[model samples]
Target: MEMIKIENITKTYKMGLIDVHALNDVSFTIKKNEFVSIMGPSGSGKSTLMNIIGCLDTPTSGKYFLDDISVEAMGDNDLAKIRNKKIGFVFQTFNLLPRTDALKNVELPLIYSGVSSKERHRKAKELLTNVGLGDRINHNPSELSGGQRQRVAIARALVNDPAIILADEPTGNLDSKAGEEIMEIFSELHKKGATIILVTHERYVAEFADRIIHLFDGKIVSDENVPKNNREK
Candidate 1:
């Protein structure tokens, strides 16, 4: 049931004459349906690790297995296919196309997968309804509030029924109330057996996850489970 396994993962960047180590021998395992949060301050390698885990970037040297398959062995085309099918990403900026309506935004993944128009419309509408945006499916990103837009993003992420939901600072742009609402949605998703990996520096936000992995200067500093009492109810 190990959804992700990383061993001695290292990522080095070449900058002019300097070698920058983004991740240094980091290792971890995340089981299926576990909610995990990765925390770090700026330049702490959180982004680098997220990129590797999301299959957007390869580790410079290490072993990465997704669902028991070796990610390190995948070609670029294979990686792209895997990313589209297995990993769903929710970004801080809500990455929706401003010109597209909510329904189209959510249907983007299915479209890429060559899902029939009728089937795509059905699935997208259902997901948007589940996320509390059924009535606003025709609204563009520009016409919706920040929270509503984020809901659309969440719906889009869930459209593919992906094995893992990689959410990076999903509430970063929201106000206190809106952020809490977004977290509530994530909590619901977790309850329903979604495997979510959230990256955030906010302690309150990180607390939503069942476990936290703290990163500093490209290495894991702490990895621990949250006490039941500390978790959001």
Candidate 2:
């Protein structure tokens, strides 16, 4: 089943007297539980596409469907609800609150979701444990290692059991070892039937995905399956 459908999507930004096209008639469909990566250089349309897919930004033209619902027609508030309920975002910055403990950070989403404190704590603990952070649940982000902090972010992303996970350069800040560890966690999530859409320019990281969508100058150049030989066993 298709979980996402983007058709002829275009994003144009008005800068001064000029119009900059960030995404040029982009189109793609992501099936449920499939792992995909979008790769491009800094100036490419990858980030723009991710924003549209995650509902952080809307397109200038064309249609978008999420789980068969017309996302293109949704209002701002509706889009916010969809983001909270259906999509999970993992950012490179490990965007946790410095003063908050891992548990509370993971629970933040649930708090906004109107879950009871007791239930939120329980779910947070479970997610923290799932991400190998059970022992550090009480530790603040300032006290955690870079990798651990990213793990906490991952836990938070999964706390809502979202239909899709959208990660933007999730391993960009980590060292090689930590980056590999993060990729391993993503691999585990994929094996467990989680749908993941990761955006990264790193070749090794892109290889971790089942399919890769290559973008250049606001256009998709290619979308292809990862060669079996390139796949991690």
lDDT of 1 at 177: 96
User: All models: lDDT?
Assistant: 0.94, 0.93
Candidate 1 local lDDT, residue 141: 98
lDDT of 2 by residue, 1-233 (tens): 99999999999999999999999998999999899999999989899999989999889999999888898878999998888888889999989988989999999888878899999999999999988998999999999998999999999999988999999999999999999899999999999999999999998899999999999989999999998788765
What are the clash counts of all predictions, listed in order? 0, 0
Per-candidate TM equals: 0.98, 0.98
lDDT (tens digit, per residue) of candidate 1 on 95-161: 9998999999999999888899999999999999999998999999999999999999999999999
Give the lowest summed-lDDT range of ten residues in model 1: 224-233
Residue 78's lDDT within candidate 1 is 87
Q: Which ten residues in a row have the lowest lDDT in candidate 2?
A: 224-233
Instruction: Show model 2 residue runs off by greater than 4 Å.
Output: none
